[model samples]
Target: MLKQTLQQKLLQKLSPQQIQFIKLLQVPTVSLDTRIKEELEENPALEDGSLANMNEPIEDYPDKDPDEQFNSEESSFDEEFSVDEYIQEDDYKDYGGNYNGDDDEERKEIPIAIQDSFFEKLQNQLDLLALSDKNYLIGQQIIGSLDDDGYLRRPIPSLVDDLSFSQNTFVEESEVEDMLKVIQEFDPPGIGARDLQECLLIQLKKKDQENPTIVLATRVVEDYLEEFTKKHYDKIEKQLGVNSEELKDIINEILKLNPKPGDSGAVAGKQLHVIPDFHISNNDGVLHLTLNGRNAPELRVSKSYQEMFEHYEKVEKSDKKMKEAVQFVKQKLDSAKWFIDAIKQRQQTLLKTMNAIMEYQYEYFLTGDDRVLKPMILKDIADRIDMDISTVSRVANSKYVQTEFGTFLLKSFFSEAIQTDSGEEVSNKEVKKILEECIANEDKRKPLADEKLTEILKDKGYSIARRTVAKYREAMNIPVARLRKEL
Candidate 1:
């Protein structure tokens, strides 16, 4: 049913300026330069003026009282700074030219180049291998089929069929398997393995013989991977006829092996430079916080636009053209002013929220320790800052702060609370820390199970359930007790 009714519900909505400010507040220094360039491209009224030209004084201007320079009304939200009346059409017509001295400097361009993938590297190695054209092509096809983690996720039979159909040539599964074995023996050792066991075994087989740890690690990975991963040391000991000391030594050797060999070098070719959003330093006993100053560039309405607006206002004779010009100037100036004001507001909000967080987790920031991190969530910060939880969350996400310890993502400090046996609330981060420490210091031969871990945490005052322990363990990427077992 169509109905028209007058509804009166008090609701809050963010203005366009406020929204723009919030987005700008979250971006770090590294991204700010790109963002400013984007803004300059989008808004004709804004430009990156020369520093020398900016300092020059404006002549023939009506003077105002010095005390009225920063009046309360000037800062009030109700005061509408209309851009429509401030900017002229003629002013913006010539504004698009290369005004910032260097044409190349004005055009912001990010240098991006295509780089070689792991498959490409493997194919290059294949080219060096002495093989028939058919074998070389099959090897290249096999290399292309491998995943980023250096695993051949596709089955041998499936790949054979794919090659037979795609290449219009009959290829046997045996041929694919032989080529895979050769690829597996490539520099990374585990590149073409189909499964975890195969991957580990391939890496183990390539280790230097002089290292006893590598030999033992190879033996464990080959024979007792299933038992070792599940922390089933008792089963492994019974199967291999090894004692606790032998098992512990073997497990320690296995621990030294890289599970993901390809990952180490991946970042070197593909890490985006990060600029810290906030800076934290200790000033005496108090922790000082500063939002990255570069994120908020000094933006203002162009001086030329301001001058044109002033000129239009001063002319005694009023005409249609003059009125239109005044309207155009006013509109551009208002937009420019709104953008600059938004930038300032964004900085204030970010500082306010971050300051509250710094105060909330004072101990953690002061002492570079995760254990000191208090039980904090988005709601806690929201309540303190008198903002919505979503607002606080947006501020937390993708925002990083540089501390004396190291630069950390702001979201890392927030953790959900878990109730202890004694009814005291503790952060999940503390529990994870305890879990990590327990594993780090545990007897590898008889690594603790989830139930045992639960009991251990219970003994330490945390009354968490077995399932909760498993969840936390999984989050930390620690496998089951059987998988965690050595020997």
Candidate 2:
């Protein structure tokens, strides 16, 4: 039995050019230059040039049929690739366009900072210590064991084993501990603490040792740390027999101690620098939007590539080598043209989408006020621009816009709408902002719980539930009331 069936169906697929465009759309302005440079290096037919001489037309362009030149029967590169099938030989010439790169000029190189790392500082301090060779090695071992938070995460027994096997020098944990104690007394107050408690105590001990509050603060930390952390002022008062004023002073003293000592000195990770992709300026109640020029370079097909294609097209068809050369040149020209067109299209799409966003959040842009920001999502801008939601998301994910007030990621401007008790719509960002203010102004000794936070929002006409309030608080990295409590 032979079975042949025909059914009606619709299929969707992305072409190579479309895929490339999607990838480029998501790339932020900061990294777009690097990505362009990479393309330039990989594609020989591509180049970087300025648009100053764009009016000068490309001379002697080619008109070779890729299908006839690189026929399937005569495959040259072993891969079953049809150059004609991949290339669209339409009118790719820009009769009045120029290159995207600048002319040859002096380039300035940014100088790199040469500074000692955090570990280097520790090593230098260890050198100043008057220890014997064994003790020096132990000191080095201890310093290496410290985590980025400046705490010794590794146990002394592990260090003992590390010295025994790795360094071939057997040493007791006691010796290692003793050296660790000396290193703990280094410049950074809590550089060698084993835990958070130790880290805080180390910093507090470094303060005015004769201060009476210091002793009480140390007692609070050492004996009733749990109560102090939970803001159980009454419990602490009963246990330590301290009045409100005295407890307040003791708690204030504890608060002054550094929780993360390593952060006080050199940073442990690479710092990121943000480069905004768009600029929105407010002038006399008018808003102007401009995309970063780096993202919209004046790209055009390579003139030399066009000339090469023209030269190859003139060669006799009988010459096998010349025909292959013609196919190669045609393929390169097609690629360069497609790349240039894609870049141009990307610029146009970016402007269209960003302009729509600017108009959608016009009030917020003019006032630079988060409260004025309307509830907006990807689909809102996508519908306005007549594009897919994914496309708008790509533009928003990594892009930043600089305003009169400051720079912000485009994604930050998008938020879901929340209906108020008055049946009015407000952005979830507004609710979060209000929630943050309420927490900031609450009594730290008896921090407002999430239930109370929800009630407070309700009182302000925002009908938010306790769970939703908790979710919002957690999203902002704000701790629960118990964790937020301060003695």
Candidate 3:
């Protein structure tokens, strides 16, 4: 079975440069600076154009064209062409640009704030508590156990065991629970609750308990949580013996309580900052689209590095060491050139794709009208721009475009076509717009159901099913009729 045979088959593969370009193409305007900074730090031959030599005049030097110098078969580094003695730093190898799609999800990274994290803030609060060393440590453990939504998810017995094994500070369940209660009263009314009911009650108890509304709200949250959540107003009224108007005030009071106190700005969670990848403007009835300048950073080959390479190339009549040095320099120069080229291509591709989308959805962009949006998919833009669907998708993911209406995700513009009674195809965005209008204007006492909404769409000439209406409603984050009921 050791026989060998020649084989022939057609195959396709992306070159290193192509792979680099593809990755750079997908990075949104938000992280482009970080990616470039990484490239600058890694390759000595690459540098920020802002810091590059600008006073020097351009001259036709022999090493002026790095692409040609890089590709020419003048010299190459092989095993024999080693220069271990001259170079002191770590040996440079082939470069593989940062990402394999950056990651499968392409989620935007939130900028890390210098301020202490949520847990740290709680720890600071714990520092103020007057307790013994052991009690303080127990309090620290409880504060650490709180989740981002601000609930103590871990059980008391579990914390007791954790302290016993990890900290060697064995304590009973009751002791741990006492410390938890003490910390829960620190700040943000519901800091230490174990469940939704406890959280709401903690906030309610912090309010004016003497108020009839607060008293009724507590009763509702404690006894009628299920009915309240399901909008069974009738059941709640009959059980509590309260009129509809009285119950309405109590519901309003309960609604004011913070369901997730941990997410409150005073405690934890950094504020979200959205950096748009593109900006579109409608001026004099004409739309102009432009990519974010940050996306196209001005990068150039390091002049000093190029000069060093030229110096090594000039001392001709040299040995293997000199040639090896030249090869190393050439490799870096090549990477620097490729990275700059990829950046430019990424910029071009982004503009191309966005332009195609703008033209495709011109009416909507012109007036900020969802009803005018056309049925568009990734493939439509891909075909127009002569690119792959995945490429279009990469551009769309987690990316925002600033427009007259507001900053919106690019994926929001794309929707499947639905047929009208006249056989005219329309974007599902139009149907959603109508559904939103219907629900927004409907009487909260008798909210329209999905079936009724479907009939309304049908009457408006959109042929849609009840399930389809429900799906659209869910997609829009609109609650059902029963949940939407006020009293």
lDDT of 1 by residue, 397-428 (tens): 86789999898888898999988777888789
Candidate 2: pairs in clash: 49-100, 49-101, 50-101, 54-97, 54-98
Model 1 backbone overlap count: 24
Estimate candidate 2's alpha-carbon lDDT, on a 0 to 1 scale: 0.77
lDDT of each: 0.72, 0.77, 0.80
Write candidate 3's Cα lDDT for 350-462 as tens digits: 78878999999998999999999999999899889877787788778757899988999898999999999999999999999999999999999999999999899989999
Better of 1 and 2 by lDDT: 2
- Candidate order, lDDT descending: 3, 2, 1
- TM-score comparison, 2 vs 3, better candidate: 3
**Candidate 1 lDDT (Cα, 0 to 1):** 0.72
lDDT of 1 at 55: 67
**Candidate that scores best on lDDT:** 3
List where candidate 1 sits over 4 angstroms from the true fold.
1-14, 49-116, 160-170, 204-224, 241-261, 264-266, 272-274, 307-332, 368-373, 416-439, 448-466, 469-487
Would you estimate the TM-scores of all the predictions? Answer: 0.72, 0.83, 0.84
Q: Which numbered prediction scores highest in TM-score against the true structure?
A: 3
Candidate 2 C-alpha lDDT tens digits along 1-487: 9999999997443444554566667777776676666667767787776634677554332221211222335322333323244434322222222223333256343454676778888999999878899999999998888886688989889999999988899998789888888998997888899887888788888888799899889888888888877677889888888898999899898888877777645674445667788999888999888888888765566778888888777867788888888888776766666566567667777788889999999999988778888999998998897777888887898789999999998899999999988899999999999989999999987899998998889999999778899999999999999888765
Candidate 2 differs from the real structure by a C-alpha RMSD in angstroms, to one decimal, of 7.5
